[model samples]
Target: MVLAAEESQNEEPGPAAPVTMFGPDFPFPYDDWLRHPAGLGTIPSRWHGTEVAVVGGGIAGMVAAYELLRLGLRPVLYEAEEIGGRMRSVPFAEHPDVLAEMGAMRFPLAATTLFHYIDTVGLRTRHFPNPLDPHTSSTVIDLEGERYRARTPDELPNVFAEVADAWDKTLQEGAALSTMTQAIAHRDVPTIKSIWNQLVPRLDDQSFYGFLAASPAFTSFRHREIFGQIGFGTGGWDTDFPNSVLEILRIVYTEADADQRLIVGGSNQLPRGIWSHEPADSAHWPAGTSLAGLHGGRPRGAVTELRRTPEGIAVTDADGTRRTYPCVVFTGQHRLLLSTVRCDQSLLPRPHWTALERTHYMSSSKLFVLTDRPFWLDTDPETGEQVMGMTLTDRLPRGVYVFDDGPDRPGLMCLSYTWNDDSQKIAALDPEERLEVLLSALEDIYPSVDIRSHVIAGPVVTTWENEPRFMGAFRANLPGHYRYQRRLFTHFMQRDLPAEQRGLFLAGDDISWTGGFAEGAVTTALNAVWGVVRHLGGACHPDNPGPGDRYDELAPLELPEG
Candidate 1:
C-alpha cells in the first residue's frame, strides 16, 4: 500500500528507529548511513561539464538528477505531467486545506534511503494508521457480516493469532526469514546471497498462493483464506496471490511494509523538495542552484522520441525541441517507452526490451472525499464505540482510512483503495458513481454513522492503471519473471551493458529488487546516479562505495539458466 499523509502541527519523529524484523542480528544501519555526509562519490575535474538527461520527474528521476548535480554534471529532467509523477498530492477542490493522495501515500520507516532525503528537506511526518501498528488507535476488520475492532492483537480473534503464528512458522522453517533478514540488516552481503540464492530457484516459479497453500503450518484451507482476507501488514493478499512469491518475500524479509509513517503535508514533498533544493555543495552549479531553477522553473515537456546519435543520445520532447546528453537515465515507466514514445530499437538490448515488455504492473484505484469532520468518531448508542478507525473488509471497498487534521480542521477520508481486478471493475465509472458505490459499502459496514451527511465535497478518484503517464501504480512481478526482473534491476551497471547502450540506464521502483516501495525507487535512482557518473568517466569515492562497487557482493542471486 502507498503511504498517506495529513497536516501535522508538530515535527516528524526523529530518524526511524531500528526494527527487529530480522531478530537481533539484523545488520543494515540505515540511520547511520543516512547521517553520513560524504555521499556516493565525486567525479574527476575532466568530467565537470557533462550533461545527463533524467527522463522522469518522479522520486527516482528527481533523486537521480539531484545526485548528478552534486557530482558536477548538469542533469536536464523531462516530464510529461506534473513533477511528482506517482507521488501526487491532490488538494480538495472545495477545501484546499484537505488533501487526497492519488498515489504512493504511505511510507515504511524501514526505507532508510527515502528518509535520508526527507530528513535532508526537513519534511514533517506523522504515524500512519497501518493495521496493528501501535499508532493506529483502532482497526475494524469486517468479513462476512462480522465486524471485529481491534486496538491490540490480543483483542483479535484466536484465529487471527493462529494465522500470524502460522505465517511466521512457515517463513522461518521454509525460507530462513530470520537468517536472511539478519544478514540483510548487517549488510552481510555474502551471507544474504547464500541464503537468498537457495530460496530463489526454489521459489522463483512459485506463486504467493502456492507458498501459503503448501506450507504445512497452514494445514487448513480456512486458515489460508482468513490470512489472505486480513493480511498481516496491509489488508488482503488475494490480489497479490497470483504474483511471485519472491515479491512477497522481499516485502516481508526486508520489513518494507512494517512500522510505517506519512509525510505531514504529503509524500510528494520529498520529490518536489529535492527538485527545488539547492545542494550545499555541487560540482558545476553554485550551492544556491536548484534543478527547477536550472530548467527554467519546470522540466522540459514529455519526451516523444529517444534514439542514439553519433555524439550521444538524443531526446525529442513533446514541444519538438531536441537535445543530446552524454548520459540518459530512463526513469519513466518501461511501457511508456515501448508504447507511448518512439524508442530506437537499438537503445536497449533485445533481452532488456523483452523484460520491459513482459514487466507486470498491478492496477490500483483510490477514492477520497473531504468531510466536514471526523464523523466516524461519533459513538454508537448500543456499543458506545466509534463506528471505525481504519477498516479492512472483503467487501467492495477493501481498505478504508480516516484522516484527522486536528479537531476543527476538515477531515479527509479515503473511502476505498482497491487493487487489480477490483480496481478494474470501477475503472470506467464516473467519480460520483465511484464515491456513491464506496459510500454504500461504508454505509453497510457502519449503518449508524451518517457518513454522507459529513461529506463536504465531491470525491476525488484515481484509477492509476488507466493513467496515461503511469500505466499502473507499481510493479508486481509475476511467477517465472525473476530473470526478466534481474535484467531490468541490474541494467544500471555499466560493465554489463554493451557500448551503444552504456549511456542509457534504467532507474525506477520497477527496476529495483524490491518494488512497490519508495526505498526501492531511491535505491535504483542512486544506482542510476552511479551509472551516470561512471558513463561520464566519473568514479565512485573510495570511502563511499557506489552500487557498482558492491554489486557483486550485494547483487541478487543468479538463477540457473534454462
Candidate 2:
C-alpha cells in the first residue's frame, strides 16, 4: 500500500481544516450551496408543475430529479434499466444478506455533496479496508512472482519507502502539491486559480507517466516501475499512466483517494433512498410526495430518441411514447448520444458534439465471491500471520480486497479488480472462468491456504465495457483533451449557447472535472438543476446563489485553442 508523503515537519499547526473536493478547476463551494438555509432556488408559481425530462436514473439523474421536485418542478425520469446505475449492488442468490458491489464500492469523505444525500437518506458508512488501511488486518504485495506481507507502511521493504519518498519529492518540486493543497483546504479561490491556471496549460499535454519520468526524483526506471505497481492511496496506478497528468493532480490535490469509506449496506442505497424519500420542505406537493410516488412507483422506459422542437425538447421512450418538456437534463453517459440514443444533430452546437465524440472512457472489471466465514483471519500456525490478507499483485488479479462483515456474518471478497488492459484481458471469460483465473493467481501467493474450500456462494463478475447501457466504466480524459472536457463541464451554463441548444443540458460524472467519483456526479447534478431552474425563468435566493449565478467569476480557466 503506497502512501502520500507526510506534511513538512516544521509546519505550525493546530488541527488543519478538513479537505473537500473544492476543485482546481471551477472551485465553487457546492457543499455550502447545498447546505444553505435558503433552499436550492425556487421556481415561479406558474411553473410549479412543469415537466422536465431527466434521462437516466443514476446518481446524477436521481439527484437532478429529486432537487427538481423540491424546487416545485415535475421531473419525468426515464431509466433504461434500474435506478442506481453504476452504483449497482448485487446480492448473492443463496446468501441474501451479503452483497457483491458490482459498481462503486468505496467513497472518499472529501465528496461532501455526495455525503449530504447519503446523510439525508439515513445511510451509514464505515472505513473501507483499502490496501494498508489501518482498518485492514494485513496487506500482501505480490509482484514479479515475489510476495511480501506487511501490517503497515513501515513494515514494507526499504525499496518501498524509497519509492514513496521519490513520489513525495516529485509532487512537491514539479506540482507544488503542498502549497496548492493548503490553498484548496482554505478555499482560497485566488491562490487556487493562480496556481492551477498556470499548471493547466503546462501540464495538460503531459501524461501521468511523462510527468513522473520528467521529475528529477524519478530518473530511475526501476523506481518509476515500483511506484506504478504500488500506487498512492488506493492500488496500482499503472493502468492510469496513459491519462492526463492533470487528472491525477486533481485526484491527489483534493485528497480524493485518502481515508475512503464504504456505504454500510451498499452504494446503491443512496440513489434508491433518494428515489423513495419524501422531502419535508418539497414545494407545491403534498406532505407525502416522493419521486417514487410521483412516477407511480417506476420510472418511464428507456429513451430512444431526443430532438428539439419549437415547444421544447422531445423525448421518445422505448414504449413508443413521446413527451415534450420545456427543459431536459441528460445525465447518461455522453457516448450514448453517439451510439445507443439517436440524438438530433441540431440539439447541440457542432463543437459540443465534437467534445462528446472525443470523450474517452476507461474499462473496468470486478469478480466478487461470498465465503462461509472470515477464514482469512485464521492464523497460520507456522508463520504466525493471518492465512490470507488484502492482496495487490502485478498478475491478472491486479488487486484483491477482503471484506469481513463480522464473525457471525458471511464474508465477501473482491477476488479481482482490474482496469484498462488488465480488464480487457479477462473480458471474454465466463463467470466460472474468471473465478478460476483469479484463484489460480491467488494460489501462488497463498500456497498453504485453500481459498476455494470456504466458498459459500458463487463468484459474480462484471465487465463494464460489455454493458450496452454504459459502454465503459467511467470517463478519464487523456492528454490534449482539456478543450473537449471544458466544453462538456461548462455546458450547463448555456446562456451563450444558441437558442436551439438552450433547453437541453448535460450533467453526469462524464461532464464533471472530477469524473468517476460521486462528488462529480452530485456537483454536476446541482449544475443541471441550476440550469433547469434558470431556463424556466426561476432564480435562486440572494442569500444562496447557484453555480450559474457565480459562473462568470468562477468558471474554469480557458486555454489557447491555437
Candidate 3:
C-alpha cells in the first residue's frame, strides 16, 4: 500500500521500494512534451481521420485522448461513471464554495507531470495542511490514551523525535535512499539503475515490516510500534507493513508524501478544465476544438467488450455499437478490463494477463464535513490553544485535516481518511453511521469543543474499496511481485509484445512503477501514446524523444532472479 500502517511484525522482504513515491523515468522532458513545438510527435496525415477508442474518462484516459486529438487522431472516449475518475471533487449543496475532495486531495511538487496538467488547466493550488506543516497551526498526536499538541518537532516527546531520526537513518543506511533520490533529481538514469540493481536483489523479496525490523534504528519494538502508529508524512504506515518494500521506497524516494498541496477550489477542476481547453495547435480538428466538443459535450457510454478484428481492434460500448479502431488505449483499472469488460484473451499475452491478476489494490475511505466556520481555529479560553488542527491518531478516525477557509466562511474538514482494514471496516457502515463514529472519536480527543454543534452541512463519505467502477483506491504490489510489476510497467513499450497484442495498450497508475499517484498515471498515459503512435506507423519528432524512444536508457532496474 502506498499509504497505510500496521503493527510491526516478523515480515520478510518482498519486491518493494523503501517507503517513497517513485518519480518518472522517461527521457522526454514533461514541460517540453506538454508544449513539444511539434505536439506529441506529428502522426502521419493519413492517420488524422482515423478513429481511436480511448476507454475510461479518468485523468489517464482524458490526458491520452487530449494528446491523441492534438496528434490528429479522432479519439472517442468512454466512461463507466463520471469524468475525472478518482480525482473527484464535490461541493456541498448548501455551501457551493466549500468542496470535499472525495478522491485525490493532495499532490506533491515532485509530480511534475501532474503539475504540468494542473498548470495547463490554470488550476490554482495552496499548501495542504499536512501534519506539522507550517500551514497547520497545530497538530495533535493521540495514541494509547495519551494526547500531545505539537507545533514543532521539539515540542513532541523524545520518542517522536527518535522515530523521525530512526526513519532518516534507516532510509540512508539501509535503502540508500539519499543516493537514489539524488540520481532521480538529476535525471541520472544510469546512476539510479546501478544503485537500484544492487538493492533490488537484496530487498526485492523483503516486506516493509522486515525493513523496519532489520534496521538498527528501530531496534526496540516500542519504537517500531510508534513509527507504525504515527508515521512520518502521510500518517501511520503500519497498514503498508505487509506490502513490498519496493512500493514504500518508491514513495519515499520521490517525496510523494512531502511538500504536498491541494487545488484551490477542487482537483476536479484540472480534468474538467483540460476537457474544455483548446490546444494551441491540433490535427484534423481545428486548433480551438475541445474534447467536450469532439464528443458533443458528453462522453460515450462505458465499454462492455474488447476484441480483435482482422483489421484492428473492436470495441463495443454499452449500447452495443461496435467500432473498430487501429489502436486502443485502455486507461482504467486493469481488474475492470478483465472482470467488468469482456476482453478477448488473445488481446494480451499470458505474462501480461498474470500481472493484471496479481496487481493488488489498497482500499481507502474518506469522510468530509463542512462546518459553519473555522471553529477549529478558535482558541480555547482556558489554555489559549487552538481547538483542533491536523490530527494523527491510532483511534477509529486515524487522520483528520482541518480546512480553514476563512474567519467567517464555512470551513471543511476531512473527518476521516483511512486505509486497508480501517477503510474496509468503515465501508460496511452507512454515511450517517460513519459520521457518528467519526464524531465520537474526535470528541474523545477534543472533549471541550462541541464539534457537532458547528456542523451546518452533511458529512459526505466515500468508500472506494467496494465501488464497482473502481474496486480499490490505488494499486499496490504484494511481496514477491517485482517480476509482475516489471512486466506491467514495461507493457507500454509494445515492441516487446507479440503482434496480436501490439494495438491494445494498457495505461494507468496501476501499470506504473509508482501507483496511487497522478504522476504515474500521466506518465503511463504518455507512454501508451508513444506506443499507439508507433503502432499507427507514426514517428516521434527527432528532437522531442518519447518514452519508447529512450526506453533503453530510462528502463527501470531489473529485479535479479532468485
Candidate 4:
C-alpha cells in the first residue's frame, strides 16, 4: 500500500502515516498494544469521579485496572508508551506479520495474576514453543545445532524427585542448617547469598550447586547407542560437598513445565480485550492514548513528579501536568516511582530505598530488519522459503534473536540482543556485518540454517539501562539475592498507615512476587485494589466474593520446605 505523496504536512492522521508495522505492515492497531486487532475501538469516558488512578500501562497497570473495575470502582490508566509497556509489539520484515513482545519473553505458571486476567479475557492460549509442536519439534538449544529435541516438560517430575531424594534426608536431619534452609525457602525477603550465608556455608557448611547436582532429579540420561531396546544411560560424579545453587536451578528446571503458556494467537489480544471490551463494550479511552488520566487528559509528556494525596495521590506528567487523586498504584518500572518520588535530602527509609539503588538491571537492544526473505530460517523442503519464527539466541556471537517479521513473501527479520554493558561497545558494527557475526554464531549452534543475505537490517533497543526509574529487569533478585523480592517491599504496600500516608501506596512486581514478573505485578495490583477498597469502605475479598476474587478460588501452590 504505497502512500499518495501529496501534502508534506497534513494535520489529519491518515494512511499517510501508515503507522509502524507491528508485523509485516499489517493494519492492526499499532499505537497502543491494548488496541490490537479490529475487534474493539476506543473507549469513551462516560462515568466520572474515578476512585483510583493507575500509573504505568504494563502488566501491573493492566492488572490494577482490572481489579479497580471489578470492585465497582473506576480507574484511569496511564502509560508513556504501549500498554504492554515492556511487552511491546514490533513489525516484521514485510506486510502482515508482527513480533508481539520486546521485554520479558517468558514467564512461569506460578504467575497467579497473569492467568487471572487471561481467564477474564476469555482468550485461548497454547503451550509456548513446546516440543509437542511438530513444526518446532526439533527445538535446538543452539542455532547451529539445528537438531531439535522435545521440550523438557516431560522430565519435570523426575528432575524434582531426583533433587529431592538426594537432599531431603540431609535437610530433615533436624540440623541447624536444615532448619535455616526451611526458613529461607519460605520467606519473601531473602536472597540466595543470604540464604546460603545463613542456611548453607554459615550453617549447613554446604554450597548451592552441591545440593542440586547431588539430587537424582536433575541428572539426565541418554540411550546406550542401540535403537531397539529402551534403556536409561548416564554418567555421574559422586561427591558429598553441597553445590549450594539449588534455588536458581528450581527457577528453570523445576518450574519450566509449570510456567503459564501464551495466548494462541497474539498476546496483544488479552490486553486489547481487557482494556476495552471487544465484541462487548470498548473503552472510553482517549484517542492515541489507549488509557488516559482523568483530569490531565491523556498523558502526553514525561511524568516528572509523584507523591501521596489526601484521598489518593498526585502526579505530574512530563508537561508538568500535575493532578491529585486518592490512590496511585505504580504499574510501570520502579524508576518511574523513584524519579517522581520526592526523596528528602537526608537519608531514605533504610534497607529499602538503598537496596533498590543497589538492585541490578541489564541493558537490552534489538535490530529489526525488513527482508524479502527470513534469512536465518533454513529453507523448507516444500516451499523453498525460510521457516517462520526461527529463533537464534546467545548462540550468535553478537547475541540476538531471529524470527519472521511477517508472513508476506517470507521477508527476513533479525533482532539482536545485547546487555546495557555492551550496547555502546558494539555500536561500530554495521547491521549487515553485525548480522554476519551473529549468523556465524548461529551456525555454530544450528549449522543447517543459512542467511547468505537479507532485505533489511537495523538495531532496536529497549533502554532499560539509562531509564534509572526501572532499576533493572522487571523483578530480578539478581544472583544470590531472591528474598528481597517480597520482604523489603511488602511493608511499603501495606495500607495500615495513617490517612495522610494512605495517600501513597506501593504496587508492582517488587511488592508481591519474588522477582520482577507479570504475575507479581498483577498480584501487587490486586493487593493495591484491596487497599483502595478498604479505603472506600468496601469489604475485603474474604468478606466480599465478587469480581475482585475471580481467581481466589484457585488453590495456591505450596513450595517444598528447603
Q: Tens digits of per-residue lDDT for model 2 on 1-562?
A: 1123334343553458888899889999999999999988988899998889999999999999999999998999999999999999999999876888899988999998999999999999999888888888989999899888998889999999989999999988888888788878877777778778778888899999999999889999999998899785798889999999999999999999999999988889999999999999988988999999999999999999998988999999999999899998999998999988999999888999999998999999999999889999999999999998999999999899989878888889999999999999999999999999889988998899999998878889999999999989999999999999999999998898888889998999999998899899999999999999999889999999999999988989898787
| Candidates, ranked, lDDT | 2, 3, 1, 4
Q: Candidate 3, residues 31-89: lDDT per residue as tens digits?
A: 55666676678778888868899999888999999889888888899998888898999
Using lDDT as the measure, the top candidate is: 2
For model 2, the stretches where C-alpha displacement exceeds 4 angstroms are 1-15
Best by TM-score: 2
Tell me the tens digit of each residue's lDDT in model 4 across 1-562: 1112222232433332211111100111112222224321111233323556677777767766765654344676667666666656555433435453455554544443366567766877654443223333322222224323232324323533343343444333312233233222232112222323233222232344344334343233221111001111110112111222332222322132243455544566666556654222323333332233333434334456665544346677766777777666666666444555553212124445655565544444555555555444555676453443334232333333343433455543434555444454444565566656655665565445444455443333344554445545544444334333333444333344445555344677655433435555655565566556555555532323322232222212222235
Q: Give the per-residue lDDT of model 1 (tens digit) for 1-562.
A: 1111222222433443354222111123334433556766777787775778999999999998998888788888999999888899998878875678889888887787788899988899888887777878789999889999988789999999999999998888888876566555555544555566667788889999998888899898988888888898867888999999888888887787877888888888899999999988787777698888888898888999998999889999999999998889988887888889899988888988999999999999999988888777767778877777899999988999888977787888898999998999899999999988888888888887788899888689999888998889889999999999988888887686678877888999888767678787877787788787777677765766666776664566667666
User: Ranking by TM-score, best first?
Assistant: 2, 3, 1, 4
Question: Clash number for every model?
Answer: 9, 0, 36, 67
TM-score for each model: 0.94, 0.97, 0.94, 0.61
For candidate 4, the C-alpha RMSD (Å) to the true structure equals 15.6
Look at candidate 4 and tell me the lDDT of residue 317: 73
Candidate 1 has a TM-score of: 0.94
Prediction 2 TM-score vs. true: 0.97
lDDT of candidate 1 at residue 189, scale 0 to 100: 45
